[model samples]
Target chain A: MTIRLFLILGLAAGMLVADPQPQPKLLRNGLGQPPHPQAMVIEKLRRMNPEERERVLRDMPAGRRQMFERRLEQWNRLDSGQKKKLEGSLESFRTLTPEQQQTVRGLFRKFSETMPEEKRGDGRRMLARLRNMEPDERKALLSSPRAKARFSDSERDLLAEMAEKLPD
Target chain B: MSPNTMSCPLQSGNADVLLSYCAHMLDEERTELIEQHVAMCAECFALAEEQKTVWAALDGWESEPISAGFDNALFARIAAAERSSAWEQWTAPVRQWLAGDIGWKPALSVGVACLTLVVGIYLQNPARPVAATPTVEIAAQELEQAERALEDMEMLRQLEPTADEEKRL
Candidate 1:
């Protein structure tokens, strides 16, 4: 009798410790892949009632909550396939080492925020081209006379850093 | 040997006569016949002796007497059971409904009410709300996701690393 009681208690405790929520059906296709925490939460919010959504956002500061909701609104506008690809990219970004992530983020900030607005368009175009080139080809392009004529030394450095560090 | 000296009752599959003799229920003539068979047949004598011992034990055995007020208590329990049975019969339909055995008409009414509630809710909540919404502690994990997404979105928008970055956040 005591053993039976202990067994039941153990099972109840196990259930309490286990994750209670079921995975969303939409994310089921990504089973065996690493967990997509962002996508999971988005899917959960998508299904929530107003009361539930309100409850979830109640603890967040008003400003942060507004910003998050705006970001989420934009996220919801994407088609399912596009959402999947975006989520995949986020997951890939998350898997990178902290230092690697920082490198990429720093490079991007330099490209977008520090660069002049007039040159930002050209920078994006050049980065786009560099993204598809082979490692040796990328080196050749960065050193080419055309690249030198088009971009400053600093812009070329940024492109070189991104081309080497960014994931395919 | 006499004509009454018969075959073994056990072999004949007629052990009831031996049982009867052991029980002292047989008439005098039948008892005398069984006794004659027992005296000559060692097997019957031994079985009769064992049977006699069992009967003697049974005769000495006494059953427990009924407690005082047993009849009253038993009748009271029966009456209580009958009263409960009537109450149960009266509530059986209610129990079934509570157990979700409700008919289609009531189920349809409930479903429609729930659907109306859901539709009312969906109508009130727009796809995007411009005003600030409340936050709670239960969404700590989800809150973390939002924070991380916001941070990542800022960085990702800067990089435009993906070929289709122009098309997405």
Candidate 2:
């Protein structure tokens, strides 16, 4: 009886300790890759012994390692939905017409650099909100005077088109 | 078999130690130490194996699902019980008064009514008459101001990051 009681308490205490742990939010844009995959791989490497870690390091050339590290940082900066969508649509993205690709690239550059630092959070939140809206509602918003005030007529129309392309 | 062993010490404090060691929840050295102890102590070996088996069995256990109404029924029961408990506590003084035969209910009701009447009369006192709608034009002007403010609030709700929009993200 005492053993059973102890076991129950032990399990309860163990569960309490674990229940609040933060789980990595999974990306769900149709890709099967885990959230923060690059970080997870790096964490696993940190857990390895010096010899095994060195062996893994030796397996990759310095140039490859540097490129991988840079790519890892870039991947880390992408939000989960973006990461998932990019992973799933890499081939399709590459196959896009040059003009389409250039437009997408220009939009990304504007988001990364042209957007003011203070409004970055608002920009991201607005993008996420716009993505979450229904296609019909987004179309209405695109035509609304509010959007026209903020974006040029051409820019507003382009954004309305991009709404269908981007994932929430 | 020994009830306790130095190797797999079944002390109250070390209750989690064996379980942690078996589950690989401990670091390498601690796990190795416990592993050696289990190998040396037959009691601990059996306990560890038993725990592993129990865990495996639990993993295989499929729970019987309840009906959709189960949660709603449970919540209703909880709400009813809470309401009854609060009611009982609130009326405890009355119950005590009844037990003592002091006629508390009538006295309490009369006191509450008197208090309500005083407050109501105080609020409706005509002495400092609430500026009864003055000349028709000023009343209309106030109504217009109110309408303008309402329109401004609606525009603000659309222009700014309102609560619902922020929460949607």
Q: Which structure among the candidates has the greatest lDDT?
A: 1
Model 2 lDDT tens row, B39-148: 87777788999999988898899999999899999999888767787778787665555455555457557556655555555455424323322112123333333333
Give the alpha carbon lDDT tens digit for every residue of A1-168 in model 1. Answer: 344345445544543433123335556425467446666666677667778788778878999888878877777776776666666667668878989988888777777766788766667667767888887888898899988988888888888888777776
Q: Model 1, residue A113: what's the lDDT?
A: 66
Interface RMSD of each candidate, angstroms, one decimal: 13.5, 28.9
Which stretch of 10 consecutive residues in model 1 chain B shows the poorest summed lDDT? B128-137
By TM-score, who's the top model here? 1
- List of clashing residue pairs for candidate 2: none
Error of 2 at B91 (Å): 74
Local accuracy of candidate 1 as per-residue lDDT tens digits, B1-169: 3426566788899999889889899998888878888988888989999998898899999999999999999999888768787778787654565565655466446556655555555455535233334222235766686667756765565556344544432
Residue A155, model 1: lDDT of 81
Look at candidate 1 and give me any clashing residue pairs. A57-B134, A57-B135, A58-B134, A58-B135, A58-B136, A59-B135, A59-B136
DockQ score, prediction 2: 0.02
lDDT of model 1 at position B160: 60
